[model samples]
Structures are given as structure tokens and as C-alpha cells.
Target: MSNKLSIVVVEPDRERAILIVDSLRAAGDFDVSVISEVTGLARHVSSRDPDVVLVDLTSPSRDILEELTLASGPLDRPVAMFVDRSDDSLTKAAIEAGVSAYVVDGLRADRIKPIMDAAIARFHMFHRMRLELETTKRALEERKVIDRAKGLLMKARGLDEEAAYALLRKTAMDQGRKVVDVAEALVTAAGLLS
Candidate 1:
């Protein structure tokens, strides 16, 4: 349980890579690993499971960006990419690809700490937004199921919406289950019968 940030650097340039590694180590308490080799870099980063990933490339190709995007998706951590030069389209693609921070021509040892901090913060904010979206989606799905079940009850038993909902609540309480669970069961059963 070390209170140190684990960092993985992917820089093809050996001199720049050393500088990046040195900067991170000097900035704060960090467990830093540098991958000079670009081949299978994403898999190596995944294996390390670093808290943050720093990619410094002179010029990144589309294939490299895609690989990085795949690495940062689903089981994503913070990713900071520093490029020598980039176009608007490339920058947009990087943001859409889940890059926490994309800095163009802003790779300096003195600036690494603050940039890394910003990247970590951005990552956390994105994570929070994703969680909120997932929670909202689940709630919406449950509501839809409950509404469908209520409609089915209304059609079958000539019950009003309130009565149908009450029945669901009562059934849930009696069965020691959630209203959503009961509603889901009813919906599933109705679907099967239909």
C-alpha cells in the first residue's frame, strides 16, 4: 500500500525517454518504468497496470494511436500524450480516444509534475462521469422494465397504473425482493408467454 503513483512511459526516443523517466522520479514519489521499445507496448503497459501512462512521440501514426486507444479503453487508467506536432483532427481523435491529457510541443521536465497532476485529475473526472452515466442508464432500464410490466398488468387484469405498481410493490415485499427485481421477473414471464 505504497502512496506512490505508478507511471509507465512509452517514448521511442531513448534520450527523451530517459529525461521523462528522470523527470517523473524527481517530481515526486513515483514508481516509473520506461518502455523504449514500441512493439507490443500496449500489452506491456497493461501488464504493468500503472496509475498513469505517458507517451512522448515525435510524430505518432494512426496505428499507434489506435493501439493506445485500445489500451486505454474499458480497463483504462490516465493517459498523457505529448507530441511534437499535431493537427486538429489528430487532437480531436486523441480526446475521443480517451486521452486524459494531450499536450502538443509541451514536453519539459519542469512542467511534467503539473501536467501529470492535471492528467490524473482529468482521468478521475472522466471516470466519475462514466459511472454517473452507467447509473443513469441502469435506472432508465429498470424504469422501462417496470413500466412495461405495469402495462402488461393493466392490459391483462384491467388494473390502473397505480394498482399495477402497488401489486408489484406488494409482491416484492412479500417475496423479500426489490420492486425492480419483481418487475423484471414479471416482464420476463410475460415475454415468454407472449
Candidate 2:
């Protein structure tokens, strides 16, 4: 389990996703979770915290590419792009969109298997340091979330820090989640209701 690699695959095509999954599983000890859209990708990424993300596409769309790029942080992992976009402008956009490894046309998965494996291995090598960075980022984001939740709770229920935290902790314990998770949930809920 400790030696296993987790990867999030954002490929819209189910068959291609399976091919990548099978190849990766055959090549290394990888736990692959495949998804189609960017929505909820961050949650999967933040929770699963995969070592790398393999995003396969025939071309680069401004919105989707940008979303995938922004996902790198919460994922705290490098992105491997298996693209068919051969246009120079789009290629440039991909690089600026946070693609760590961008492979253009004429590069199929089999031909690039070794490179992908190496990239994934390198990602794991830096996983610890990346985890530290993500921990710091998460802590900072948690502070902001908790503060917002606390403010809402205080305004709505007149509670102090200790009481607000106690509520959050109890909610987390009951739900078998982290206090930060509860805080985030609360904040999200507040945002929706307000």
C-alpha cells in the first residue's frame, strides 16, 4: 500500500481511459481513478491527492485547459498532457496553462510509456516535499475557511471561537471527517444559502 501510486485521470473517453489505466497498472502499482469533467476534480484531487494527473485530449480548449492547470496546486502534482493539439499557439497556451509535460501529435501512449513512468516516479520522489507545501497551503486555506465559518456561526448563533470549534469538531467526529472538512462544508453551505 505504501508503495502504491494514485493517479487521477481526466479523460472523457471511457475506452481510452481504460487503456491508460491498464497500461499504468501493468507498468506500476497504480490506483487510477478516472473522471470526465473538471467539476469535482479538485475534491477528488484534494482528497485522493494523487501523485500525478494524466489529462488526455485531442485539442486544448481555453476553459478546460485553464481549469486543469489551476488544479495542479490542490493536487500538488505535476500534470502530464497527452494531446493531439499541434498548433503552436495552443501549445504555448498549454505551457502557460500549467502543463508540466506536454506531448503533442504523433506521440501515442505506448511510445511514451517509459517517459510517463519516469515522470510519475519523479513525482513520487518529490511527493514528500510537495506534501509539505500542500500542507502549508491547506492550513492557510483552512484558516480562511474556519474564520468565515466562525463569523457566520457568531453572527447567526452568537458563539465564540471555542464554541465554534467545538461544534466543528463534534460535527467532524460524528461524520468521521476532519474539522477542516466540516469547516469547508459549512462554508460551502453558507455560500449556497446566503
Candidate 3:
């Protein structure tokens, strides 16, 4: 019921972590927690279930990047990573790990709000794209199954495609199920009999 954004800041340095927390508080009314240790980062972040995560690192290693990837939770939430310096490989790795906003030497108190906003926006965009892709894939699979069922009906009952589809749709309406479900069942049964 609370509208406050819950944020987790991962920083190994105590002083820097405090600074980041203060910056977030100054930016807005945010509920923030800081995790100073890199060990078991995934567990810590998962336990918090934050709306967003901010990871500030002086230099990130492959192991740390891997930990960050796991901590991001399959892109469940937005993650902003600020690094003092980074190379092409590190930047690529961070992006691949689902860090929505990857900043190189741009971690300032003044920039926190905008960076956070961008990260959240990017996360939403990617999430929407992912959902659309899944829906498209599912629909394509359903179409294939329905076509196979129609093929079976046309061959077995000597009916045209239109008639076969009409039978499938009528059965689906009578059974109060989706056309895809009925088609899938028919396909499964045909496979079994064969």
C-alpha cells in the first residue's frame, strides 16, 4: 500500500555507501538499505525485495559482475551500476547482466534522481518487450497446433479446411474451452492413436 520506492545500495566502502544513501534520501522520500559486503549479495538483495538496486563499485571483477547478475533476479527490477572506470568487456558484461543504467564515472548526488529514473524507465521498456515476445511466441505455437489439428480433421473426416476449423470452434464453444485447448487435445489424442 506504500508508494515509497524501496532501494538497495550495494557498495563495499562504508563511507561511500553512506554517501549514496544520503544522496538517495536527498533525491526523494525513498526507503533505502545499503549492503557493504559482496558475499552472498544475491541472498541479501532477494531478502530485501527492493524496487530498484544501485551498485557502486570502484573496480568490478568478473565474479562481482556474476554476483550482480544473480542479484538482479532475472531482470525483476531495475539496477543501476556506477563504476569509476570500465572497459568494453566490463560494460558489455554489465549490460548483459541486466543493469539498466550503467554509468561510468557519473555517480554524483545531483545525478542520482535522473539516473534512477532512466534505469526504471529502461527496465519497464525491456520488461514490456519481453512480455510481448513471449505472447507472440505462445500465439505462434498455438497457431501451429491448431493447424495440425485441422490437418488431422481434414484427412480423417474428408472435410475442407474451413469445415475442419468450424468443427473445432464449435466443439470448443460447446466444451467452454479455448479453440487452442481443444486443438491441442485433438493433436495429442491423434498422436497417441498413431
Candidate 4:
């Protein structure tokens, strides 16, 4: 497949929308699409599978923000929202709704490229952070399960902590399973018996 970045622009104003589109076209080798309608925007975005989405609005309502969230958050596409004016509360709401970039009264042709670049970069950074958080959480949960299993083994067999861990390791090696798998199995069995 071509390595060009795909971009989708949702601009209600036809005249101003062209300005943004033209700017993006000038930025680099970008496959750009502009949608004049706001209804079913998420579905359209899903079908397009754009790398980034730019939403230009006079003033965004809650429903519009929600639609943008659904379009960008679930689809995992970076989005930049340009508005004529915005308050602190709305800005906070936009971020909460998963808007990567919320620009207020700052829609210049020259700035579109950088804003889009920043949006994409921020989205990727956040995505990586989220993945790391999930992995850390899983590791922590597995550690807790293993600790619980080790405690059970120590109490039942009158073994020391190290001996309990060794026994669990030995069982896991013999069964050709992960330590977490064996630990989970033991914990489940212990729970069932009690």
C-alpha cells in the first residue's frame, strides 16, 4: 500500500473547508477527503479509515463533541478541532471526549499542517502510554495472583515462601504452562474447595 497519510476534514462551511483542504494538500503527499455533513460522521470515518480527522466548526455543541469522540476515540484516529471561540469548560469537555487537539480562533492555512502533525503525534504518544498502562496493570494482577497462590502453598504444605515459589515453578514447568496460568489454576481450585 502507499505510505501516504490519509486525512478527513469535516467542515460545515464549503468555502472555509476548501481552505483547510487546500492547505493539507500542500503539506505533503496526503489523501484527503472533506465531508460537509455532520450526521453519521463516525460511520463515514470508519469506512474511510483516515489517519487523521480535522473538524472545523463555528461553535461545537455537546452532541457534535460526542460525535467527534465516537469517530476518533473508537476508531483510534487523531483529530484536530478548530473553532471560532471556546471557553475553558468546553475545552475540558473536548479533551475528556478524546479530542487530540482543540484549537480556538486559530484556523490559519499555514498552521493546519503543524496542528495536524501535532494531533497525530499526540495521539500516538497517548496510545503508547495507554498500552503501557494496560500491560503494567496486567503484570500487577498476575503478581497478586502468584503471591496469593504462594501463600496458599505455604499455609497448606508448611513450606517457606521461597520453597512455595519453587514448587509452583516446578509444577508450571512440568505442565509446560506459564507461571501465571498455574497460579490462576491453583487459586481457582483453592477457592472452589473452600
C-alpha lDDT of all candidate models, in order: 0.64, 0.60, 0.65, 0.64
Question: Residue 182: error of model 3 in Å?
Answer: 0.4
Which whole-number lDDT from 0 to 100 does residue 17 have in model 3?
58
| TM-score of candidate 1 against the unseen true structure | 0.48
Q: Count residue pairs with overlapping backbones in model 3.
A: 0
The TM-scores of all predictions, comma-separated, are 0.48, 0.35, 0.49, 0.48
Candidate 3 yields a Cα-based lDDT of 0.65
Instruction: In angstroms, give how far residue 86 of model 3 lies from its true place.
Output: 31
In model 2, pairs of residues that clash are none
Best by lDDT: 3
For candidate 4, the TM-score is 0.48
Assess candidate 3 and give its TM-score to the true structure: 0.49
lDDT of 1 at 158: 99
Per-residue lDDT of candidate 2, residues 1-194 (tens digit): 56455567666667655766676677766677777665665455545655555653333532354344443455244343544444455444434443333333334455445536544443343445657999999899988988888788888898987898888889899999988888888889988998
Q: Model 3: how far is 56 from its true place, Å? A: 15
Per-residue lDDT of candidate 3, residues 4-117 (tens digit): 767776767676557557765766787888887777776677567666566532336224544443334464443335433344544454455444333223334344444464
RMSD of each: 15.3, 17.8, 15.2, 15.2
Cα lDDT tens digits for candidate 4, 1-194? 97666667666767655766676566576777887776776667656766556653233632454454433355354444543233455344435434433322333434444545544444345456768999999999999999999999999999999999999999999999999999999999999999
Local lDDT at 27 for model 3: 64
Clashes of each: 0, 0, 0, 0
What does the lDDT come to for candidate 4? 0.64
